[model samples]
Target: MNEKQIEGLLEQHGIKLTANRILIAKVMSTLDYPISMKELETMLLTMDKSSIFRTLSLFKSHHLVHQMEDGNDIVRYELCHSHSEEEDEDIHVHFYCEHCHRTFCLNEISVPQVNLPVGYRQTAVNYMIKGICPDCSHR
Candidate 1:
């Protein structure tokens, strides 16, 4: 996405527009998969790790981004596709490629619905498929 579109998304999510945040969001918009904090830090070398972490935290709080643990024990973040303010309908399946160690967001494949007990409530859901991705399978 363009910088202006990224800015609009941040604004829509009630996040303050800052240079570092914009830069990070722009980079995130260009990515096709969830990224770890370490990877983001490497890509954005000019920004300090703490600042990036803080920005990510802020984004998470605002529902602009979602975090997931990619089987390797690394926390990764991806932009939220469902911008709903009330319910998190963006909960979708993720594919973790064991060979490349990459986490991909299967946006089209949504998480299945579950019927909880009378007193139970669901806040979030994570459904992941672990296998060799197309690239790895081809190789």
Candidate 2:
């Protein structure tokens, strides 16, 4: 997405269009898969790590992004596709390639719903599948 579209998205989500936030959002918009903090740091070398982390935290809290653990001990973040700021419609599965050590967002497959026991509450869910990805399988 272009900077203008990115800015509009942020504005729609009620987020301030700061330079750092815009840069991060732009990068996230261009990437097809989730990205880890280390990867983002490598990509945005000029930005401070703490600033990036703070921006990510803010984005997640505002439902502008969603985070997931890929069973690799590192958390990755992806832009949320929800229409409203308070709602998150990006409840989908993630695929982790054991061979290449890369995590992918399986947006087409929705996360299955689960029934809870009495008085039980569900806040969040993470569904990850680990295996060889297409690239690894082809190799």
Candidate 3:
């Protein structure tokens, strides 16, 4: 998506349009996988640390973004493509490239229902698969 569309999405979440928020959100939206802010910092041209953090906080609060845990504990962020007004959490598969450290959201794969005890609270679900990504495998 273009920057304008991204701006609109951010606005939908009640977030003001700022250069850093737009920049970070654009990069996040463009990703085929969840990515680290460090990788994000590498991709950004003019970014400040506080701005990225604030943007993430806003995005998460609005359910516009979801955090995924890869094996490395980076607390990666990906677009909650399914998030809406009520913010219903769905179970989906995430792919992680060990060599390149990229995480992909596998929307096509859905998680099976699991039995839980009574009064269980499940806010979010994150399931990840790890291997070398195709690009890294050929390299």
The TM-score leader among the candidates is 2
- In model 3, state the lDDT of residue 49: 67
Per-prediction TM-score to the true structure, in the order listed: 0.92, 0.94, 0.80
Model 3 bad stretches (over 4 Å): 83-85, 88-91, 131-139
Candidate 2 at 105: error in angstroms?
A: 1.3
CA RMSD for every model? 1.4, 1.1, 2.5
Query: In terms of lDDT, which candidate is strongest?
Result: 2
lDDT of each: 0.88, 0.91, 0.78
Q: For model 1, how does the per-residue alpha-carbon lDDT over 31-99 read when each residue is reduced to its tens digit? A: 989999999999999999999999999888888888889878889998886565455657789999999
The residue-level lDDT of candidate 3 at 75 comes to: 86
> Whole-model lDDT for model 2 versus the true structure?
0.91
Q: Point out where model 2 deviates above 4 Å.
A: none
lDDT of 2 by residue, 1-139 (tens): 9999889888888899899999999999999999999999999999999999999998988888988898697999999877668878778999999999998888999999999999999777779999999999999
